[model samples]
Target: MKIDIVSVFPEYFDVLNLSLFGKAQAKGLIEVHAHNLRDWTHDVHHSVDDTPVGGGAGMVMKPAVWAECLDELLGLEPADATPDAAVDTATDTAAGKPVLIFPNPSAPLFTQRDATELSHADHLLFGCGRYEGYDARIPAYYRAQGVNVREYSIGDYVLNGGEVATSVMLEAITRLIPGFMGNPESIVEESYTGEGALLEHRQYTKPAQWRGLNVPDVLLSGDHGKVDRFRRDEALTRTNDIRPDLIEQLGCKALDKADRKTLMALGWEVSGEHPRRRGK
Candidate 1:
């Protein structure tokens, strides 16, 4: 997949060159490009923002620069296309038209589900807003022109800019693309992925016995069946304690007789009230 990120602090994206993403790029499994938002500016100051309309506390990004940049990137005619240009159904775009991405706290929370889904896109264009954010009309104008636009938020808290969130989201999205990782099965059991309804099981390394702490005995037993059972139990226990919300979302049916028994043993509330477990 190809992803283009437009941000005032393009340097913030330099970290994308590290580790797996770097390797993925080397292997041509994915492509990423960072563009400076200021390049669209025509004035000497290269200012991207001004006072927000309606008297806001923070500055709002200027619409003209955004429109010019996006128009050029999306293949809209520079002469005819402007932020205030009339919306139309024309589909012309540079190469594979990217699905536009805007991160906003007001938008739906981004999830592993969304990441997995976006990994399939042929191209993606991420708009990283600083200050107050991009002019509201930018996305609205694009959407009116038949562009596919999606908005997502990482969490409830706000940040100085969208670069960090975009970086995180890019990692999540890219790793899911086939061939991005050497081991195809590596992501199969990742938490929030398919069939991984519970939190990921705790991982361990060498030094079977460190100080007074010892690795789980089952892990050393080489008994694949027993090891699998142990891992499942740990995952279930962790999820039940740390994120019961995920368990609740899985609902009663997700807990079969074995899972219920494990939870019961862990002192979780799975007694007569949860009658469905009795038949499982």
Candidate 2:
């Protein structure tokens, strides 16, 4: 996969040079590039933002610099073209549009599932905004051209710019790519990948009898059959206590008859409790 990020503070991405992502890049499993948004500017100051047209607290990113940068990066003609020339170039751009977008608060909430879907794309473009925000026309222009434009948030809070948020998202998606890790099995068995409908249960180490608190005998016994059953039951028990929502989403299939009975003992109805009966 190829990802191109357009941000004013491209230097922030220097963190990517020494991590799991860096190792992945060394193996050529993916390519990641962060371009300075001001590189397309022609002026002495090389400014990228301006005061908003309407009275506002913060400045807005200018359209000219964005147009120049996007055109050069994507192989479109210069911004000074006449109407016919603009139309011709736009027609060509319609043939190859970017598949991803990072928008403001109005878009859908991002999720692990969304990251999984985006990891399969051939190309993804991240538009990072600073100060007040991007020129409103930018999103409209992309949408008119039939590109897949979407806005996503890391959480309910706001950040200084989208670069940090983009980084968070990029890391999530990159880790899911097939050859990005040394052991592919690690991805399937880790917490929250849904091999089981719960977080990774408690893990114990070499001191089987630390402080006289013994490790479960099944694990030390080397009986894989018994170990599997113990781990699943423990995971289900932990989920029922901490994240009951997961238990609710998990059908009866997630819990055997014994596990269901355990949950019921904890005052958690496995299924089919009427709304009123499920007390406050």
Tell me, by lDDT, which candidate is best: 1
Name model 2 segments beyond 4 Å from true. 75-97, 103-106, 195-197, 204-221, 253-255, 272-277
**Maximum-TM-score candidate:** 1
Superposed by TM-score, candidate 1 places the C-alpha of residue 183 at a distance from the truth, in angstroms, of 1.6
Query: lDDT of each model, Cα atoms only?
Result: 0.80, 0.73
Query: Could you give me the TM-score of model 2 versus the true structure?
Result: 0.78
Distance (Å) between predicted and true CA of 89, model 2?
A: 24
Candidate 1, residue 41: Cα displacement in angstroms equals 1.0
lDDT per residue, candidate 2, 1-280, as tens digits?
A: 7778899899998888777899988888878889998888889998999999978799999988887777665555543323232223223322444564665655577777677777776677888888888898775565554455667888887788999889888888888889887787877645556533576678889889999799988899888978887887777678767877666666555557777766666666656531111454
1-280 in candidate 1: lDDT tens per residue? 8888999999988898899999999998888899999999989999999998899699988989988888888887544324444333223233345688888877889999888778877888899998988888887878766677777899999988899899989989898888888898988777877743778899988899999899988899999988888888888878878986675555555567777778777655554434222235
